[model samples]
Target: MRTLFSKCLVAPALFASTLASAEVKLPFTLDWKFEGPSAPYFLAVDNGHFADQDLSVEISAGQGSLDAIPKVATGAYPVGFADINSLVKFLDQNPGAPVTAVMMIYDKPPFAVVGRKSQGISTVADLEGSVLGAPPPDGAWAQFPVFAKENGLDMSKIKVEPVGFPTREPMLAEGKVDSVTGFSFSSYLNLVRLGVPEEDLTTLLMADYGLALYGNAIIVNTDYAEKNPEVITGFLTAVAEGVKDAAADPMAGAQAVIDRNPAGNVELEAWRLKLALQDSILTDYVMANGLGDIDVERFEKALEQIAVTYEFKGEPSVSTIFTDAYLPASELLMMK
Candidate 1:
């Protein structure tokens, strides 16, 4: 009886060891704080999507869209979410930073110049002589020049104020600045939280004005991706599932985010998640081509648009910056 019991214990221990070895530890970095858009990922965690792919993913909040680019480039984290345009410039400066976008989110690109309707910023032309608060590292600010140029606004006429991310909205609410550069979903909701009426906000979406730009994407360290292609694929697969789940039931996704961030307002964050889904994530192209893919032709035009504002050290190739080789099947990626 003692020998039989010992044998059972050995089998269970080995099984435990196998489970531990089989699970790949992957830490994911996000572009911003825990908010509505982040819900899908939390839902993925709650639903065991990562575990289904034999991955143990840990998602951490970020400071801004540009924050996670270097984290992944340095191999400090294997995968990260960041602005793809920022990645383009980083690659241009670093020459070979080992970071490239694998999955495209924010298909419509949330970069926008948000102004208060009551502050004489109802039109893009209104920014010509108004105070514009801009965060230096903000993804929207990074693309503001393009937005300005496309809209035929003289940037020289626009009075720019450099502000911290935390103060960007507050300053606007207090009438410190007439306008601000930020993501549409983020800035719009932020002002709402600051007691600004929804009707008083004027969101000048860059994409609507003629900037053919892509937004944030899942970026990976090339070295890490090369060594662990399967892991990258699994991570993306799990993320796609998360996005789908979020789209299906945004409220549930918001609940997932609220679970991790108790301070967040569930109703507001749910609406925010819904805003991201409708305005940025689930676009006509995304819905038609399925998620985790991009139109090469449109991407090329976007690269050309970026080149207008940014000088590239080495020639940038669309294929080099992004790849769909690791994407799951269309059925798995289709959000609909």
Candidate 2:
């Protein structure tokens, strides 16, 4: 009986060892640097969610929202995080690129025009005649044209200063530019850290104004996905669990990011993660319906909005841009 018990224990241990050795290495690329918003992914790695799915995920930071699309399309990376709006444009330009958004992370895009009240900018109209600092590659900047059209702002009147990502918030903080384009949570907190008073900032979220668009999503190489559907589904399932874990205890999520980014501030990252959860990730729609999926009707409206500024080379449809095929079952995605 003792010998039988030892074999039982040894069998499970050997099985676990086999599973560990069989883990598929999936290198993930993020849309931006390792910050608060990126914590959930890190949590997935740290909390063993990826390991549970037999995936060994290695995340790499990206330069901008558009950075990962091309990398994934070229098969440089199997999966990545990127702006869905940019993915639309990229598909239009490239035509038949083997890349598509698999899961919707940010229900409401954090795209916004953040300005200081002291600069005489309080509303969207104030942007007219003001020097607006914008990074050309910024996802928010890319959507600005649509926002302007929706709000009836004459683009010709607004002086757009092409600034680098690092300089965007600084120019606004130094009073060089009246306003800047960036993710609301990122720009607002960055300015606050720069000694800009919280009350002095005017954050005009594009979603609140007139823009109907989705934000950053989990993207995949279609070729890779086609060959390994189960792998993609498992990856997304792990990510959903990571998001839920982060949502349940934001500080833990923030700690995950800080672990990866030793230079990150725990409190600040926690605050940032909270803002993302409150404003973007945990929306009413996501709360009611669950995560990692999109409302087809809303997605269609977003595509129409994108059409206002970008001329599509071919007809864009829900099937081409996004698919729920790789998303886990509804039960696995629900967040409480």
Give each model a TM-score. Answer: 0.91, 0.92
lDDT of 1 by residue, 137-162 (tens): 77789888888888899988999999
The predictions' CA RMSDs to the true structure, in order, are 2.4, 2.5
Q: Give the TM-score of candidate 2.
A: 0.92
Off by over 4 Å in 2: 1-13
lDDT of 2 by residue, 1-336 (tens): 569889998999999899788999999999888899898899899999998898999999998766789999999999999989899889988988999999999999999999999998999999999999999877789889999999999999999999998999999999999999999999999999999999999999998888889999999999999999999999999999999888888899999898888998999999999989988999999989999899999899999999887888888978989999999999998887
User: Candidate 2, which ten residues in sequence have the lowest lDDT sum?
Assistant: 61-70
Give the winner by TM-score. Answer: 2
Instruction: Single out the weakest 10-residue window by summed lDDT for candidate 1.
Output: 88-97
RMSD of 1: 2.4
Pull out the clashing pairs in model 1.
none
Question: Per-model C-alpha lDDT, please?
Answer: 0.89, 0.92
Q: Assess the local accuracy of residue 72 in candidate 2 as a C-alpha lDDT between 0 and 100.
A: 97
